[model samples]
Target: MTRPHDAAILELKNLLGPKGWSMERDVLETHNREARGKFEGHADIILFPASTDEVAKAVAICAAHAIAIVPQGGNTGRCGGAVAGQDQVLLNLKRMNRITEIDARDFTATVEAGAILKTIQDAAEEHDLLFPLSLGAEGSCQIGGNLATNAGGLNVIRYGNARDLVLGLEVVLPDGSIWNGLSKLRKDNSGYDLRDLFIGAEGTLGIITKATLKLFPHPKHIATAWVAVPSPEAALDLLALARRTTGDAIAAFELMCGFAHDMSVTHLPNLTRPLASQTDWHVLIELTSSRPTDDLQSLLTDLLGDAMEGELARDATLAQSDAQRKNLWAIREGIPEAQGFEGGSIKHDVSVPVSKVPDLLTRGMAAARDLIPGIRPCPFGHVGDGNIHFNFTQPLDMDKADYLAHWENLNRVIHDIVAGLGGSISAEHGIGQLKRDELAHYASAEKLKLLRAVKAAIDPDNRLNPGKVV
Candidate 1:
């Protein structure tokens, strides 16, 4: 039975036409949940807007009726940001998947909100350019969602986060007005930078309908190597050495604990050990150059040789071929998925200063183990950038629910350590509903007041993504 909200639903249905909107149960069910299965809700209707104008019209209708709007993109967020309540309307942007333009001369790409990250990457590659915002979910995650949450991935060490890669955005304001600020120019030092406001707002401040993203020259020569470092400190030292030796040629510097790699090898098929010797810590390093004559392979080889000689690395393996390079990356990328085969894993995507990464890992691991004896720590990620996926797999043979019950307690313990180290509880992921309370707890009263003021100024009605972020 269609609920009493059918009046508004019918109005939206007529406005969007049958193809653009749906009140179907299956669609609502699919759109109402987050990827992590941690948060779930219900939506009376789901609207699909193909263009910015259509999005504005839908927002206007929702605004007039005082109906809450939950703007979603690919529904790939780890947090409950995209989940909608029964009272709210689910606004899915997948149909807005369009690469409007690729300006190779200006080194920018104009894309609709729903364009998949991989699609944009391919489009840029076709023009012999690169869109470096890459993550494990690149295959499915959309650029809008990436920009909304200000995603930071493997390339963040070199390219920075999603916000750093964007030049402009076209947003639909809370009252149905559109902000056409999609400027491709590099320098637009106008009054306030409003583009930065919505980038990491997670759809709370405004709905991001389109974006103009920065691009780079495609790397012509690339080199990849996996080195077994002595410790997190050693990994940091190697990162410094690599940067000094290769200059800005260091494209990616990823750190993985030995146990994390072992889990990958144990669960993921076709992924073998990259390093010959077993070390407690590992770092996957990559160097790229647009100039084919750069000879990145020799540079990486020399860096690894020097690191081993300096005792920073216990052992090292440089990729001899393109196949070998991909194999090495596969091991790194496969860790997250392989972890699922273990058991219920409590995950924390935290970031500290690069100098404090070793301290965070050392102290955090000890604290978690002390809290729950037999807990397995699988900490890894962009250590060069200070963001670590500090995840804890359940103790062996432990009940999943029982282990998960300690999620909040364990989070406090780990987050307190992160706080002491002057780190962020969330690095890449934004403060969605999952971290909303935590953000309130950690953020100062002045910061919270400013956040609320911004939200009130822009969205006084509180109709856009209510109960999220601030």
Candidate 2:
């Protein structure tokens, strides 16, 4: 029995050759599921295009047949942006992984969409440069997905998000037209910035095939510290103090609740607690200087001393050795993973103004507590940039499935608070299937109209990544 879209799938398979497309169960399972097991995706055929030409041809075939295309990278996204649906073609780009050019003089790297983030960072390091976009999934996540999500990571405090790091992108549009905008130049006063339109579009308008990314001088002098703060308010004060103290050397400023720290240690039993003095809140701060002569450690020590004296911080542990620095970072980075050990955890990636972060924390926690009593509020993240991974662990007595049932209700209350504070509901994470309706509800009518206009203008048939961010 031949299906209506079978010819399109056959065309893609023929175009990609035998090695390009897969119908195997295991391969489909991996490509179809979300990273956190929240959503299970579906696709009739999953493809692995080898080059830009192959991708363009495949997309053209799909467009001609009116077949839906779900462009996927490493599938490490939390928002399920790359997750495909029934009858859609999953265009996985892992085979296209290539760092085509690394121009040290230009401080730019042109890489294929499938290149692993950590691989690019190491490649940059080899040239005595730095590609600073980093997160928990750096080892597995692809650069294309990072750009699609406009990813913000540990370095965003000093460097900026993935959007800020990218100079240009090469995209295969819905109609299968290749737009090579891979410019390495920092400045371009063009009519309209088309690169940005595709960067965070989640593959709705186009499939990002490659990118030219900005790199910086690798920091030679580095300092890391775990400081205890009384509360979110004190954390903000410490953030201000560190920013002024470090100048442009500030790399990361993370805030965590006491329970978040405890969960990290518990998740990895071998992990060492960075600080002895446990308080309600903690801050993991890092400062880096490219200059070899900069006394970053001494400066950090002095800054911590001042912060402690001013009562902005309670206690601090400075990482004296590289091993100690790694230990501190390990504890800080393990927070996202540690949530899984606990029962069902409701997650929110929201951001408010740095000043209003305190209010967000207080009000959000209180509201969640009222909704679900004894639900452990494990809030933590890059407080320097005001993005908090405000998550709630299910109660001891509650069933995991039952607790997850309140996901929608919980999101509404917390998101309402975020709106009141003039904060973004989906900050670093894009509005994937998880928050598509939420985007519609919270977004202004004018903004929604414009977004739809753009989507319609690019993908007239809604065949490119349908059921995604509009």
Candidate 3:
């Protein structure tokens, strides 16, 4: 027996031609599952639209049939946002992977939604420019997903979030109409700024088809260091000192807990610790400059002298070679992947004021201990920007399933502290199914009302990526 959505899926396949979609069970299964190991969604048919025109046509047919669509990019999202339901059409935009234009003069690049982030970054590097949206999933995550989720990475302290990098966007709305606002101009005081609506909306209001991104001059001289800090409080002081000493040259300032580092090193025995001193806290710092004459190495050395003398840092290791620098970064980036190999981890991608991060960590860890006595805290992330991945690895003797059962309770405990500190429940990762209820629970009545109003105004039928961020 044919289902109602089956007709819409059939129409979509017909609209895009046989080569544009996949009905094979394996392909459908792969796209339906999320990266978090949580079985979230199911889609019978997947659509592969090659261009904005094809996307518009497919969307129009779906709209005619009142069928829902879940637009997927690289499917590398931490949240379950990209997964589509069994009754919905999965629109994978990988075929739209094109760096349509690179304007060296304007310092902008126009790219299709499916373009891989690393591909764009490399293309920008070839032109002696930098994209600066560095993240672990850059190699696999697509530009559209980054934009849709407003992805924040290592360079956010200097470059800013994914939304900050976008100059303009071209989006396909719920009614199957195209909004081509892809302006390359840096300044456009035009009405209601529609580009932002789709960039971080998780494709609920519209599907991002293309984007024009801002670029910066490539850094020439680089300085990297791994320092042991007394505590999170001292780490903040070190960050302040680095910013004051180096000004705008600070590219990345990260805070890592010792357990996270040990997990990574233990998971991959070949990877060594960046620092010899075994402090509970570590800060990975990097400074970069476009000019070769900047002498960031000397600047960093002098800063480390003051940090150590002033007691902000206990000990430090500076990267003397490019290979050493990459190795340092490899350790930092490998933490999340390493956690996967350990056991069940209750993850929280959250943020507070930079000033309150120390308090958040102190109180949050204490609270987790009170709730689950033997739980291990693997907290780490951008101390410069206030976002911390306050993750908890299960107790050594606990069963994986039993530990995971505390996911919701732990979220409540941590989110309660976050709410007390006036912090966000979901920072970089959007409110996919995992946190949809949490959003409603934490958001102010006025804010929730406004959000629903906007959704109703743009997507009245609840067709575009339904049940996502409203």
lDDT of 2 at 21: 92
Error of 2 at 353 (Å): 0.6
- Model 3, C-alpha of 153: deviation from truth (Å): 0.9
lDDT scores in order = 0.91, 0.90, 0.90
**Residues 1-470, model 2: lDDT tens digits:** 12327678778778999999998999899889899788888786798999999999998988788788899988888887999887788899999899999999999999999999999999999999999998988999999999999999898999999999999899999888899999998889978999999988999999999999999999998999999988899989888888887786889999999999999988876689887776889899999999989999899999999998999988998999989988788888888788888989999999999999999999999999999998999999999998999999999899999999999999999999999999999889888888899999999999999999999998889988888886
Candidate 2 residue 427 Cα shift, in angstroms, is 1.2
Model 1, 1-470: lDDT tens digits are 12326567777888788789877888888888689899997887789987898899889988877899999998989889998876888899999999999998999999999999999999999999999999989999989999999999999889999999999999999998999999997888879999999999999989999999999999999999899888999999899998888987988999999989998888988877886688899999999999978988888888988997999988888888888888888889999899999989999999999999999999999999999999999999999899999999999978999999999999999999999999998999888998999989888899999999999999998999999997
How well is each residue in 241-273 modelled by candidate 3, as lDDT tens digits?
999988768999999999988878778756777
Model 1 clash count equals 0
CA error at residue 396 for candidate 2, angstroms: 1.4
Q: TM-scores, in order shown?
A: 0.98, 0.98, 0.98
In candidate 1, the residue pairs with backbone N, CA or C atoms under 3 Å apart (3 or more residues apart, or in different chains) clash, namely none
